[model samples]
Target: MRPSTQIKPISLLKTQTAQVIRRVCEDREPLIITQNGEAKAVILDIQSYEDQQDTVALLKILALGSRQIAAGEVKPAGEVFERLRKLER
Candidate 1:
């Protein structure tokens, strides 16, 4: 199991916004923002966030493809390309 990572409240972060953001970005770490003593949002580095989102999208595509294959709805790679080639003619 992965260890838990904790972050301070947003109000406390307001004091050293630049420093805190920089540290989190460099570390690829997530910061839990809180309001009224409750967790409100999470802040993450843009690149790290993008990478995670891309991974999710790729996984979804693979899952859909797997489902289609399981249902016998997929075409062979060569046949798919041949059909496309005819369409281009």
Candidate 2:
């Protein structure tokens, strides 16, 4: 978060929606939308949102791999590579 970033009220969002959208896209930062001085929602550009989703998906995959390893459901790297090579043939 930037030092200059401020929480915007819902009223301001309703009135200056276009400006908010433009700023979010240009800055690639999420805007905190507030209501009654309470944080309510977040506004993000499409690309940033997609990037966040991708990052979360990758984290989930890493966690799953760790769990599998802990459960002893793992294989040797060399054997996995050999199977892949056979599949490529």
Candidate 3:
């Protein structure tokens, strides 16, 4: 995040929505939309938004796997591979 990046007021969004969209897409950076000097929302390019969603989904899956492991709800590696091989058939 660059300190020099200007934060736009929410009111400007009503009139400069297209400009904001173009800038964010071209720079691949989020625009902070502010209201009354406080951060209110962010505008992200479609690719960045989807990438963020994917990252969050992956993190959730990893968290679930960690919890399962902690609960001893995991099979041995060889056993898991054997089951996968059977499924392949």
Q: Clash number for every model?
A: 0, 0, 0
Candidate 1's TM-score: 0.76
- lDDT tens per residue, model 1, 1-89: 12255557787688988988897888888888888878888888999899999999999999999999999998899999999999999
**What lDDT score is found at residue 9 in candidate 1?**
79
Worst 10 residues of 1 by lDDT: 1-10
lDDT of 2 by residue, 1-89 (tens): 77347578899889998998999899888899889988999998999999999999999999999999999999999999999999999
lDDT tens readout by residue for model 3, 1-89: 68458578999898988888998999998888899999999899999999999999999999999999999999999999999999999
User: How close is every model to the real structure, measured as TM-score?
Assistant: 0.76, 0.86, 0.86
**Which residue pairs show backbone clashes in model 2?**
none
lDDT of 3 at 12: 86
Rank order (by TM-score, best first): 3, 2, 1
Identify the runs in model 1 with alpha carbons over 4 angstroms from their true place.
1-5, 84-89
Candidate order (lDDT)? 3, 2, 1
Q: What would you estimate as the lDDT of candidate 1?
A: 0.84
Model 2 misplacement above 4 A: 85-89
